[model samples]
Target: MGIGEHVGRNLVTKSKWTSVANVQYRTRRAGQPFPTAGQLSTRLITEAKRTAERSWLGEVSAVVLQQSLRDAETAYRTFFASLKGTRKGPKLGAPRFKSRKDARQSIRFTANARWNITGSGRLNLPKIGAVKVKWSRALPTAPTSVTVIKDAAGRFFASFVIDTDPAADATRMPETHCTIGIDLGLTHFAVLSTGEKIDSPRFLRRAERKLKKAQRERPASRRDRRTGPRPA
Candidate 1:
């Protein structure tokens, strides 16, 4: 699963823990949001099935899935803890799965989807109410997860991970449109391709004397060695 990192602000919200607990309870009762570990295992199973079919390798077993889930949970917890004392880190909250798909290479799930929405487009979350996303680009395949990131600049962005086949026409064409050469000299700023010369304004030369005078006239202090005093 591929993991995409989006950095932005305006996607964070302030919801009380009690309210979130109520929502979780309702979602569990309704079978909306799957448990985090369950979601991870399901995704891993899908990956193993795909790998086994495509490659010479066989399908992965529950052992691999368990280990992967453990590693992921540990990483998640560590990351969450590290966010403490950070200027704009999200508060402690239960992680929610956004989607499930294999995109680039790894499987990713969107965590904190509710708190990571922006703009006015409807975000169809599992159990929580629909949120408004900024609706940038649709994923090539379905996104396994979305990570809402907030940058120091106070911007909010939603990152989606979608597995897709490599593009066939991926080569870039060489530039063949324009060829221009210019020469620069002290007398003239630039001589363009068409042989037009541009003059350079020497602003520093004009202000040199005044700047030198200002620097010279600035206050100077002398230290008396005996008293360890400064005389202005």
Candidate 2:
């Protein structure tokens, strides 16, 4: 999901004639082993429309568009850094030109408000955009970082990281527990192991005829203004 979103957003930027980053992932063939990064890079450059290029940062840029390539790289780096391990991944590669059909959309800032929290209630983000947050339970310690993301659905969501103490359950189990078995049959809704039976209301069966009649009737339509039909 993460890599796909990055590619999709970059594709959008290329549509605006801005720069973009060319990126590729490695996959294994049916009977072949997974390809190495070098092999993937070679394939991408060979098949790409433009010659493979590199930014000052030194990465394959053959098929990348540049509008938000830098920003996307930054976001990707930030994302991996937040992961549990593998913090020292390769630096972001340079951007390259996109094919004519691949270039068509650009990124625009829409009116979206997102929030994040460091811990239980302390909000944190870049540029000191701190605010208060509400949590159902308190955190044990402060969070390492927080990020806010907005989606095309026009909804805003926040992701928070926090260190906390593990919760301990103090409830005791009861010794005198009773178990009951229930059997369901067509004649009775439920029959208990103690010989008790419960009847079924079968509401839908009782109202079947009325419901079918209502569904069969055609609903009245509004009068047509152009045709001068009178309202019923």
Candidate 3:
């Protein structure tokens, strides 16, 4: 299945949890004993599996659905904590429902999901096939899990949680009292305290010049216009 479908299934699962929370709140307000968090959590999972138009849930790993629900549970827990003035920082409103129209979408896969990199370097996801990846850099250690994220700008990224040994890191790190000051400016990229000058990258200016040159070479779109129909 496509990434979009995976995200859509997650959103549907998230919405279901929100609806269940609202229902439970209403029951409590009506002077009836609402099901406890544990009860609702278990029941909701079963309900979500049998929910119509949600067979796609079975196609994806159960972790995705569970994480989305856990997210909702955490939101509500935080909201209640805020009301009681137990949660630090500013007060928070109740959790909002997830919408398909939202530009950003994400799904995380923990170690339990068994997602990993193949010998050929393709990302192998559960249910989702191996996807060709353009790795930015080499990983220092094996990632515990990966979160596939699509941002509002339509950019896709795979974020990883890498657990490294603190002792190893300390051994690798060298102790030094040396310090350097950097001054950033528009004219020059940076000036170091050691009197080193670095020229500005001017990346944007270079791209703009190339774009203008291409525009000059290409013919205008207006030239292809029919202009009230051609000569048959």
* Highest-scoring model, TM-score: 3
Q: Summing lDDT over every window of 10 consecutive residues in candidate 3, give the lowest-scoring window.
A: 222-231
Residue-wise C-alpha lDDT for candidate 2, range 1-232, written one tens digit per residue: 2322434544544422222122221121234442333443443333343444422112212223332344444554454355535557654443345442442323221112233455455654322245455555654454454344444433334454665444422233444578889999989999999999999879778678777786667454642356666566
Q: Which ten residues in a row have the lowest lDDT in candidate 1?
A: 6-15
For model 1, the stretches where C-alpha displacement exceeds 4 angstroms are 1-121, 152-155, 167-232
Error of 1 at 18 (Å): 23
RMSD, candidate 1, Å: 20.6
lDDT of each: 0.44, 0.43, 0.80
Candidate 2 vs candidate 3, TM-score winner: 3
**Backbone atom clashes (below 3 Å) for every candidate:** 15, 11, 0
Deviation of model 2 at 15, angstroms: 10
Give Cα distance to truth, residue 164, candidate 1, Å: 1.3
Models 1 onward score TM values of 0.25, 0.25, 0.74
Kindly list the per-residue Cα lDDT of model 3 for residues 14-85, writing each as its tens digit: 887788787776686678664444565566666555877654568877877777777788888788789889
Tell me which of candidates 1 and 3 scores higher on lDDT.
Answer: 3
> Distance from true position, residue 107, model 3, in Å?
0.4
Alpha-carbon runs more than 4 Å astray in model 3: 29-41, 181-232
